[model samples]
Target: MAPVDRVDHNVLERTSLQTRLSEDTNTPEEQLKDIIQDLYQIMVQVSTYDSAGRSSREVLINEIKTLSESLRTLHTSASPPNNLPSVPPELLEYVEHGRNPDIYTREFVELVRRGNQLMRGKLNAFGTFRDILAENMTTAMPELRDDVVQVVEATGGVPPGRRNGEQSQSQPQQNGANSNHASSSAA
Candidate 1:
């Protein structure tokens, strides 16, 4: 088979597998909802048992039987698909504490975004420091100027004093220098 055809076939297979897995994951949740609805109906029938009279007893009994069957289906469906991801303990704990899981997810996402922003700030600070240090060291030791330039270019850093447009202009030079350095180093 052609390489392109093989890749398409593999992609189709993966899509099919994911579709099946998602359906499997939802099956138990759907079953549980069905069981809950059945219970609610049975409760309603029992509550109106006296008003419903003799016929109510038969309806209540039928509802109870349906509820029993739903419970059995739920029991069987509760076995999760083998490849399904397990619930995180922290999420389970949050729910057990009576908090909404959606709130927990939002809070967790916000926490991660804050952490990422903090780390990004740190990384920017370090990059700025690297550029300033490189500029100063180049001035202090003219003999090491070439090596400093190489390091700065290889790291895709903007040299001190280069701003927006100038920074963009330097990118191609930096990329070329970086690739050359990478190839030479590999050799």
Candidate 2:
């Protein structure tokens, strides 16, 4: 593989360009969201592989599950990912309203660029255990992706990249009355 910086830069540039799509890029505003979303997912897969490696992703994932459960007990602390991202005001207003077209004509975007950069910066973190995600993702089973993502969470990297499906699935099920509240927590 190329140097980590090279790979990371590629991913970062891809994400930035995807997220900042405008008329000059010529992608219709309607399609921009999906395009950015797809780009985000690709970056996520790369990040998962880059950060977690291929060996211990599943075990690391289980560990994160345990940690997440424990975090619920830290009365004075808060789970990190649940906080709203400090997106640019233009983005936030659209997000606040569930993508109401009337509210933000340029349309909406999930703010994953910063998360990707953070994940890249921490790509070599947590020693060898971090490689687990990459190893796990190269295997069979759709669930492999989940395991890799959980491992990323365990390493205390940024929340799962939405493009990679990591950020979205981490949310607890909204099986009850407050389903809407459970919505944005994934991002």
Candidate 1 residue lDDT tens string, 1-187: 2222112323433353344334444577786776686677666666557763776676666666666766666666676666578788899998899989998899889999999999999987787678767767855775786788788888888553243324443354444345444533553
Give each model's clash number.
0, 15
RMSD of every candidate to native, in Å, equals 19.4, 33.5
Q: Write the per-residue lDDT of candidate 2 for residues 121-154, one digit (tens) a residue.
A: 6664543334433333423344666666576668
lDDT of 1 at 82: 65
What is the RMSD, in Å, between candidate 2 and the native fold over all Cα? 33.5
Model 2: how far residue 70 lies from native, Å = 47
Q: Estimate each model's TM-score.
A: 0.42, 0.16
